[model samples]
Target: MKVLALEGQKHIKSFIDFPHDLYRNDPNYVPELYIAQHDLLTPGKHPFHDHSKVQLFLAYDDQNKVCGRIAAILNNNHNAFNNTTDGFFGFFECINDQKVATALLNQAELWLKKQGITTIIGPANFSTNETVGLLIDGYDSPPVVMMPYNYSYYLQLIENAGYAKKTDLLAYDVPYDTHNDRSVRLLGALQARLKRSNIIIRKVNMKDFKNEAAKLRDVYNQAWDRNLGFVPMTEKEFDYLAKDLKMIVNPEFCLVAEQGDKFIGFALGIPDINQVLRKVKRGRLLPFGIFKLLFGLKKVDWLRVMALGVLTEYRKLGIEACLYGLIIQNAISNNIKGAECSWMLEDNYMMNNAIEAINGKIYKKYRLLEKAL
Candidate 1:
């Protein structure tokens, strides 16, 4: 087998298309859009390149058949914020063979070591700000849009390669039909109390998205500053991400808390576009794939409460509960069957408690692996 660095346009195409062939028979696997992946991996197209660097590699058999792929990333912001030189490996896909997995990981580690990195941590496709973690549980069903799905054996392959668990990220499922009734009853009262304090929760204003996103940027940076591996996003990066999400942002599920004219807290729920994207085939929208995405949007049954944050001074004021309640209410009204509030750090007690209060069940688990290079 030979490992090759993805260089020219042809190799780049191979890098993006490899997953389609790898998971063709896996019913639960979704093919990410080829265009989106291309833009993201391209240096100037995605904001990650502004402060970080990444290298893509593809492994091939003696016959030149693509066998595996991996990405080695050096996130300068992550290193500067955490005060450690840690590299990352993401977009990892390999055959069931342990040797293939080991070879891909070893190459990634060696590349990072050459850059003076001391530790390697990932399966973070690019960064924690984007899709991160390898799915270690919940393979019975397809992942929600933007969430990850992987073969169960990949876990063993990673462990066999000598990476230890760094942290486990949890994803909880809140079924509309069986959610905790007590919390549902309390939601009304919570909203009433919040109203008395002049805190209003409303859908995001699309007309003012630029301004709304700016307010959210402030709240997000402040709210999650203490999170493990947290890094403040640059303006360019934030805007780039906001623009991508804006296309699918539902005003009803994307909400904000306001006291008079000041934005205090926010919650963003996006339709699991992965449902539609699963049929997108190699992540391309053109050549007939666009219609599936365009029409599938209306039929998406799941929503992901990807982000929810409240200002520190606003804690315990029921603002967090209100944000969740509003999103749940929208979910119910839209006839969406369930939602996943995800990728939460295992140690986030406050957020976990709030989700548990609403009878959210821990349904999926993803882990970040680490090794001393």
Candidate 2:
């Protein structure tokens, strides 16, 4: 077997298609959108490339058949924020072979080491802010919007590759029947009490979205500053992401918490686009996929509560619960059956408890792995 740097459009196409080809028989595997993936991997299309370097690699067997692929990434922003020379490996997919898995990892490590990184961690497509982690549990169902699903054996392959568990990301399932108006009933008192402090929750104003997003960006950076592997996204990075999200963002589910005119915190939940994307074969959204995606929004019954946070000083003021409760309220109002508030840090007891308070069941687990270079 041999590994080669992805050097051409042909190789890039192969890199993107490998997973779709490999997961052909896996019902739970959802092919990510081709355009999104393409733009993400291309330097000029992603803000991450502005402050980092990423190299793609593909493995071939003796027959020259593609056996695996991985991305070696040196995120200068991450290193600068943490004050450590750490690297990341993402976009990993391999057949059930230890040699393939180990080889793909070694190639990434070699590249990272050459760039002065001493530690490697991931499964992050690029970073913790994006799709990251290997699904270690809950393979019975397809992933929700923005979540990832992988072969069940991937856990063993990554472990065999000598990567130890650095952290686990948790996913919870809130049953539709049970989620309706529950948060409102449970947290009404808390909401009223907090109202005395001049905090109010309102739908994100689409008319002022750009400015609102900027404020939320500040809160986002401050809210997760101490998280493991946390790195503040550049304004360009946040704006880039916000642009994509705005296309599908529902103001009702995109909420903000404010005091007078000052933005204090926010939470955003998007309709599970996967509900429609699931029918878009190979993640192609052009020919008929766009129609399915556009017309299928009304059929989307689940909301992926993607982000929820309160300023550090605002914690314990019930703002988190308020934001969560309001999202649940909107879900209930819209006839949306359920919501998944997830990819939460496993060690975040406070946030975990908050989710659990709303009857969010821990239904899936994803792990972020690490290795010393």
Candidate 3:
């Protein structure tokens, strides 16, 4: 086998298309949109490229067939914040071969070492801001819109390559039909209490998206700062992300909590666009792809509660429950069969308990791996 760096359009196309063949027989596998992958890999188009460098490599068999691929990334922002040199491996795909997996990991490790990196962690497609983690469990169902999925054997390949578990990211499923009645009952009461305190939960104003995103950014940084591996996004990055998500943000499900004029908490739900993207075939959006995406939106059966947070001082005030309840209520009204409130830290008891209170089941598991280089 020979390892090759992705240097041209052919290699790039191979890098993106390898997974289609790998998971062709897996019923739950979803093909990510090709154009989105291209944009993320391209330097100037993604904010990650602004502060980090990445090198992608593809493994080829003797006949020159693409058998595996991996990306070695040097996240300057992570290193700068933690004061340690850590590299990352992402956008990884491989056939079920230990040798190929080991070779790909070794190549990534060597590349990071040359860049003075001492530790490596990931499966993060780019960063925590994007899709991250290896799907170790829940292969019975297709992933939600932006979640990751991989063959179960990938876990063994990774462990055999000397990587150890760094953390587990949990994904919960909340069925609109069967979730806890208590949460449903308390929701109105909580909203009433919040109203008494001048904390009103309302839909996001698309007309004021810029200003609304700015306010949420402040709350996001403050609320999530204490969580494990949390990093504050720069204003530019936040705005960039907000612009992309706005296209899918449903006003009823994307809500904000305010105390008079202060933005205290928020919840964001997005249609599981992956359902449409899976049919986009290599992520292209030309010819019929764009039509499929646009027309498929109303048919999506699931929603992903991608973001829910309450400011630190606002904790214990039931704002978190209010945000969740509102999102759930909206999902039910829209006929969304189920929703995923996911990628939660394993130790986040507060959020987990709130989710459990609403009958969200921990259905999927993703792991972050780390190793000394």
Determine which window of 10 residues in candidate 1 has minimal summed lDDT: 179-188
Superposed model 2: Cα runs more than 4 Å off: 8-10, 180-182, 186-188
For candidate 1, lDDT tens digit of each residue in 65-85? 999999999999989988989
lDDT of 2 by residue, 1-373 (tens): 9999987455788888889999998877788899999999998889899889999999999999999999999999999999999999999999999999999999999999999989999999888899988999998999998898889888899899898999999998987687545568766787788789998888999999899999999989999898999999899999999999999899989989999988889999999988888789888987999899899988998899988888899898888888888788778889898988888999999999888977889999999999999
Query: Which stretches of candidate 1 lie above 4 Å from their native place?
Result: 8-10
Q: lDDT per model, in order?
A: 0.89, 0.90, 0.87
Better of 2 and 3 by lDDT: 2
Instruction: Give the CA lDDT, 0 to 100, for residue 203 in model 2.
Output: 94
Please give, for residues 1-373, the per-residue lDDT of candidate 3 as tens digits: 9888776455788898899988888777888878778877887887877888999999999998999999998888777766778889998899889999999999999999999999999898777767899999898988998889999999999999999999999999998889886766788899899898888999999999999999999988888877755667878779888988999988988999999889998988899988887787656788889999999998998999988999888899988887887777778889999899988999999999899888899999999999998
Candidate 1 C-alpha RMSD relative to the actual structure: 1.4
Which prediction has the highest TM-score against the true structure? Answer: 2
Cα lDDT over the full model 3: 0.87
Q: How much does candidate 1 score in TM-score?
A: 0.96
Give the total clashing residue pairs for model 3.
3
- Output the worst ten-in-a-row residue range by lDDT, candidate 3: 4-13
**Each model's TM-score, in the order given?**
0.96, 0.97, 0.96
